[model samples]
Target chain A: MRGYSGDKDAYLKRLRRIEGQIRGLQRMVDDDEYCIDILTQVSAATKALQSLSLGLLDEHLKHCVAEAVAEGGDAADEKVREASEAIARLVRS
Target chain B: MRGYSGDKDAYLKRLRRIEGQIRGLQRMVDDDEYCIDILTQVSAATKALQSLSLGLLDEHLKHCVAEAVAEGGDAADEKVREASEAIARLVRS
Candidate 1:
């Protein structure tokens, strides 16, 4: 998130929306909604979260990792590794 | 999440904790924490989320999927597919 604060508000807003979606999902279950209906909502919520993750990844690459690379030392190596790991996790997800 | 109300409170609490952790990580980055240190916090926060995913997965399997399978029809097939897709996403992450 380092120098990526420019988009931080957007990220937070998206996350809040996702959170509301999740709460709606829980309420669907509580109300004993139809199975397929609930699943559809789950799919939507999951996609929203994945979108958030991708956005964060982009910010990390452009700001934090970019800074590390500019610094050119142990910091660079750490940031690169972290970014790679994050990408790997998202890809696996 | 269908039929999983028994542990709903616990899930909500954990999700709240994870949300807080994510905010804390963002703060760390904003405060110009060292690269590796921020990464460490990110790792912790990610693990917390993974834990929440696992819990939800368990609930889905035991309640939603289980009920669907017991019903023995289109519902069973749909639930299984949805659950499989969810697991696939989590694994990819």
Candidate 2:
């Protein structure tokens, strides 16, 4: 509700579709789909996941992190830590 | 360089600080900061991290996902899977 605010439903719907895609990929692998084809599909899925992750990260910066920085309290420090962990995930992924 | 392509330096700087914040939190825990205070800090950090994650997710959706969906090829299906995994992470987090 915080950053997602008005876009929750849309975001969730998108996520559900992505999930289906993943399941499909699993099926493809199970069926012994061609290696290149499976990899192509995997690459596409990876890109999509990256897109979604980036979107959420942007919202967080614009709203929560920005606000905390402006407010300058314990909250700000905490936000910094939170943001760091998120970035770590992004980097690893 | 996909989504963060334009903002790479800025993003990296922000992430570095977040890492510091996390380290600070670890120190706080080690020093036995008040339970409430530690939790408060943890909460703040958690929120900040969520913000960052959401931001990245947003960008991915707007750029990569949108493009793939438009193209409607193997790419689109892969994107769908990728997006789904990202969402799953968000939800679990």
Write one digit per residue (lDDT tens) for candidate 2, span B1-93: 475567678668778877888898899999988899888877777767776777676566545655565555677557646765665577555
i-RMS values of the candidates, in order? Answer: 4.9, 12.3
lDDT of 1: 0.64
Please write out the lDDT profile of model 2 over residues A40-90, one tens digit for every residue: 988787777777777776566545655665565677557656755675577
Q: What tens digits encode model 1's per-residue C-alpha lDDT throughout B1-93?
A: 355567767756665665566566556545655444554554555565566667667777888789879989998988888878777766665
Error of 1 at A77 (Å): 1.4
The global C-alpha lDDT for each of the candidates, from Candidate 1 onward, is: 0.64, 0.69
Best by lDDT: 2
Weakest 10 consecutive residues, lDDT, candidate 2 chain B? B61-70
Off by over 4 Å in 1: B1-93
